[model samples]
Every structure is written in structure tokens, then in C-alpha cells.
Target: MKFWQSVEHAVTPAHGWAATTGAVVAPVFHYFYGTGRADILVVLLVCTALDWVTGIQAAKKQDKTYSSEYGLSRLPRTMFFLALPALANLLDRVMATPGFLFYGVTFGLIYHTWNSLTANAHRAGWPVPKAIVNLVETEIKAKTERAMKQKEGK
Candidate 1:
């Protein structure tokens, strides 16, 4: 398949940027920091579980009804953690990039960890790290309660 087709096929909600961040990038970082391959898998699983728990928390906090779609979308993302190495190997063969698997894992772990941090901080009314804060301003001195007050006062 062509590159666009590959991207299109991969562009489901489950395989989108958020899931990649949570499953791939987060685990990749742990792997980079001297984690063994097996340990990296464990970390990926942990991060996926964390994603689910956080998703549930967010839904509950918002009083939103959970859908089967949400669960379905999440499953493939978790699976991507396991599949990425193989996929990267294939890509490596095709692109002549030797470290494709490593790149895949490292990027995925980094993405997920940063995403998790940002989401948790947002939920808690705190600021996430500037490195992954996206478009939001990073307010250093404002605690949760103060942020809430400032938000309400606005």
C-alpha cells in the first residue's frame, strides 16, 4: 500500500495521536532509560491501564455515559504497543533505517507519558510540564484551588 493509504488505515481514533502518546511514546521513554524489552512491554501495559483509569475518571467527573465505542477504540491502541516492534522492523527493511523498532518504541513512550501528564494536570486543575503543555499556558505559581478561583472569577 502507498504511504497515504497506510496513514489512512492507521488513522482511526484508537491509533490516533492520543493513543500513540499513551501507548507508544510513554513506554518508549522507559525503554530508553535502560528498560529491557520485556520491561518495556510491562511499562506499556501499565500506561495503557493508566489511560483507561484516567479515561474513566474523566468520564465520571463529567457525568458522561461511557460507550462501547470508547472501549473498542482503546483496545487497538494497547495492542499497538505489542505490534509496533514488528511493524517497525518491516519499515526498517523497507526504508533502510536500522533503528526503526527503537525509534517506534521510544517515540511512542515519550508521546504517551507526556500526554498522560498533561491530561492528569488538566483534570486536577494544575499545569502540566511545558515540554508537553500543547497550546495551554504553563502557570507555575497557581495551585489547583487558586486556579479554580481564578477560573471562576473570570
Candidate 2:
């Protein structure tokens, strides 16, 4: 108990940042890994890391000052994207929709993952062709708009 208390004291966040993160992520991590679905979590973690790293690289490559302010703005969005699929999966189970919502959301997550990766690549001056970038951007926007319209219709 003393050792645990000492460890807790050492690792505690000044505010609630660390605790909040653990509370949100730990259960998901446990559930996936515990059920031998760790590959899903691993893929997600890898995508998240790559997105952040490339985002930083892009910022440094583009911005003369490279302030952390812009970077901080992305964290909440990243956290939201990371959590969205899991929530959709839970909803699928609750609704008993035969994987429809889960698959749809998972596809969206993966599409957005690649889209972000492509954007980061372009921003980092990776020679992404203008035509391909435009095409993908247009398609993604259309798809997103369709989803929004459908949601509104419901």
C-alpha cells in the first residue's frame, strides 16, 4: 500500500490531465487486449502516433516559428477521433444492428486516418501529386457531407 501510494504521488498530474486520460483510455486498452483483440488497438495506436509525428514534421517544415500552440489545438481532436470508433462499436452492440454502424464508423475512421496521413505527407513536402490530393479531398468532402445530410434527415 505504501509503495502504491508513493508511486501514485510520483505519477499524479497537477490538474486532472493524466488521470482523465487514464480513465478514458485504460478500460478500452484493457478490454481490447484482454479479449485478444490487441491487434485492433495496436493499429489504432500506430495510426495515432504516425499522425502526430507527421503533423509535427509538417508544422516544422512549414512554419518558421513552429509554435506549440497549433500543435496543442490538435490533441483534443485526435482524442475525439480515437474514441469515436469505440463508441460506435458500443452503440452497434446496444442497437443490435448487425455490425452496420460499427462497420460504417470503422471505415470512416480508417478513411480519415489515411486522409490525415496523406495531408501530413503533403504538408511535409512529400511530393504528393496535386491531382490525387484534390481528388481525394473532394471525394472525402462529398462523403462527409452526405453523411451529415443523412444524419440531419434522421
Candidate 3:
């Protein structure tokens, strides 16, 4: 067997798999986020990862065993995070709202995840400043209130 033939044999399957995955995933991503919004997803994913790491550290700090089951529990929450924005984007399109619902839902999820990350870091004995924590809580509260008011008005 020639060296180039072996190389092609090894790479071809991986390339096909990647291409197939991209074909499916790219359309779904564009459907949900359109264009120029992947940063939102990236940030949310990064925040979730940081939160997971901090949660593990926090569990260790408290002398608790971090279970794989607990880690796997994030799957549903992550799905919710993704689904909410997609739903909101659909609503925005239907309502002709120009990305308002999508951005709001995505940012809200990001903020919530950030809050969780900070709490986990604090639990892990990190010196998470009180002011930062308070600000997050305050913004969450304000957003909630505003949303409630909007709902009431409607």
C-alpha cells in the first residue's frame, strides 16, 4: 500500500463525518440564530463550562463527592437554554420584531448563567466580590420586574 493511499484511507472517513455533521448542524444553527449571532451561543457555552468547573470545585470544598449524575443533569438545562432562544427567534420572526425576542432571551440566559457561575465560584472559596454578586441579583430582579410589567400591560 502506498503512503498516500493509507493517508487518504485514514482521513477520508473523518472528513466525511465532519462534512456530514456540518451539513446538518449549520442549517439548524442558521435557522435558530440567522447570521452574526454565534457569539451568544459561544459565550453561553463558556459560561456553562466555567460554572460546571466551579461547581465541582465547590463540591470538593464542601467535602461532597461530585457525581457524574449531577454533571449529566446539565443536559436538560442546556437544552432549555438553547430551546428558549430558538423559540424566541421564531416568535420574533413571526411578530416582525427584529431580533428583540432572540437577543432578550439569549442575554437573559447568559446573565442567569453568569450569576450561577459567580455563586459557584464563591462556594469554591473564591473571593467573589459582594458588590458584583449584589449587582447580578439586582439586574436579575429588575429584568424580572420589567418583564412582569410588560406582561401585565399586554
Candidate 4:
């Protein structure tokens, strides 16, 4: 009976892959987030996904070019930025610091990504607030100025 059960279990196929994967990942997630940080991760992921979908729509509408290759080329950067919160969490652990840097940088990235998503949505013909768009432009201008100054100094 035990041998038959073992064989049955083996042949039944694994429905627990997702569960097993989550179990494996749970420790790593806890190691970084400790607890109560799932919201940050969720927001970042949601923003990234919306941004990509809107990006495709915007490109198709405005540029009339839906190039998967171009999108794929940009994917690494998108993924890296998306993963910055994990780096922040790791930094908090290793440096024995308060999680301010983690929250600050991650929330900032989330905001920036959401802003991009909104811009893409607006371009794709959705009505986004003018103020929101203006804010994005202002931030870009400030960043550009800072970068220009750095270039000049160099």
C-alpha cells in the first residue's frame, strides 16, 4: 500500500509547483522585507506592468510602430529599476540602518514609474490631469538641469 501510494503520488503530477516556489521564495522575501513590506513590492510590480501595457498602446497610437524588439531591448532597464526596492531592503539589513532609504528610494521609483505609466496612458488617449503631466515635466526639467551641471563640471 505504501509503495502504491508513493507511485501514485509520483505519477499524479505536481500541482504544488506554485506553492513550492512560493515556499522557496518566502524566506528570501522575509529576509528582505521582514514583514509588512508587501505593499511596496505590489505597488512597484503593478506600476511596471501598467507602464509596459500603456507603453505598447502609446507606441501603437502615436508612433505607429509596435516593435517587440525595441520593447525587449528596454526590458532589462525596466526590470533593474523594478528590482531596486530589493536592493534597498538588502541595504537596510546589511547596513543595520532604519528602512528609510529602502522606503524612500522604492516609493520614489514607484512614483516615477507610475508617472511614466500615466504619461503613456495619456498618450494612448486617456485623459490624465494636466497638473500631473506638468509635474512630470517639471521633474524632468530639474533632472536635466542637474545632469547638465554635472556634465559642465566634468
Best by lDDT: 3
Better of 1 and 2 by lDDT: 2
Model 1 misses residue 82 by how many Å?
3.4
User: lDDT by residue for model 1 over 42-131, one digit each (tens)?
Assistant: 666666676667655544443244456655876787676656755665566567776656567656774665466456455544445555
Give the per-residue Cα lDDT of candidate 4 at 119: 73
- Displacement of the residue 69 alpha carbon in candidate 2, Å: 2.1
Superior by lDDT: candidate 1 or candidate 4: 4
lDDT of 2 by residue, 59-121 (tens): 567533345775697789988876776677667667877556655766677767767766766
Q: Which candidate is the best by TM-score?
A: 4
Residues 76-128 of candidate 3 have per-residue lDDT tens digits of 98788778988998899899998999999889988888887776676667888
Best-first order by TM-score:
4, 3, 2, 1
Higher-TM-score candidate among 3 and 4?
4
Give the lDDT ranking, best first: 3, 4, 2, 1
Against the true structure, what is each candidate's TM-score? 0.45, 0.58, 0.73, 0.75
Error of 4 at 23 (Å): 1.2
TM-score comparison, 2 vs 3, better candidate = 3
Give the clash count for each candidate. Answer: 16, 0, 0, 0
Error of 2 at 9 (Å): 27
- Name model 3 segments beyond 4 Å from true: 1-11, 63-65, 134-154
